[model samples]
Target: MGEHPRRRADAQRNRDRLVAAASAVIAEAGPEASLEEVARRAGVGSATLHRHFSSRAELLEAVLHDRVRTLCALADELLTAPGAGTALVTWLRAVVAHAATTRGLGPALTGYASDPRFSPHTMIREAARQLLARAHREGSVAPNATVDDVLRLANGISLAVDSLADATECADALITLVTDGLLRRPANG
Candidate 1:
């Protein structure tokens, strides 16, 4: 027989808490953060955490999947925004922010790049592609700009400023510089 609905809901809630706690702990304590700490943060026991995610890799994958889903959703919402160029810039900034927070998990995520079920790389690429296409169509961005270019630039900026005393400000400044360069110039200018 199937599991009881309330029990299933409770299980799902526990899973959500674990993922959230893991994300927070990892963001603050790096990828090496303890699973026990994650359980503590979630207000659940270690056993519950294990029941939901058998291993660290599985937990990290879940966190990455959740984050990527969020980014993709943001891209979709921004696609219909009033200004294509602005939307692209906004989306890129968000991507950079997420990258900064998840930097510690970079190595772990790389291993899952080949695993179709857990990989967020493709979704991220497609989101960038859609945003870039819209900006190009609107004539707000350089004709030659590619998704790879934007992603590389954002990732670079994120990594470069991650350790600065004013990292947020620095990132914004760098993004502005890049966005200005990306803008389409008038033929007569």
Candidate 2:
């Protein structure tokens, strides 16, 4: 016989609560945030958290998955934004800031880039590619600019951001410098 509808609905609710709690906790405490706190915040017991996520890694993947979805959604929305250059710049800043603030996210993303459960790299790459293509068409970005070039550059900057005393400013400054140079010059130039 199939599982009871009420029981299934309850299970889904618990899972949703756990993920929401985990997102907030992870944002505050980084990737190593305590699972116990996640459970408490979600109003679920430890056993329930364990039942939903077999291990810390599993829970981390879920949180990371949500972050990846958010980033991609932003990219998709920016595709139709008023200015292609502005959209590209905004999305790139968001990507860099996300990596900078989310301590351990870079390493986790690298380790799991190929994992379907958390394919941040692949998804972000496609999103960036679309943005870049739009910018190129508008003559704002260099036509030859590839997604690999920008992502690699941004990834390197985020890694460097780890040691800087002021990470957000550093990320923005560095991205601005690079973008200013990478963009196309005006007719007068």
Q: Name the best candidate (by TM-score).
A: 1
Each model's lDDT: 0.87, 0.84
Error of 2 at 20 (Å): 3.2
Tens-place lDDT digits, model 1, residues 92-128: 9888878767746868755653346655778999999
TM-scores, one per candidate: 0.88, 0.79
Clashing pairs in 2: none
Q: Please give the lDDT score at residue 173 for candidate 1.
A: 84
- What is the C-alpha local distance difference test score of candidate 1? 0.87
Question: How many clashes show up per model?
Answer: 0, 0
**Model 2 lDDT per residue over 153-179, tens place:** 888889888667678789999999887
Worst 10 residues of 2 by lDDT: 105-114
Highest-lDDT candidate: 1
Regions more than 4 Å wrong, model 2: 1-10, 106-118, 164-166, 180-189
- So what's the TM-score on candidate 2? 0.79
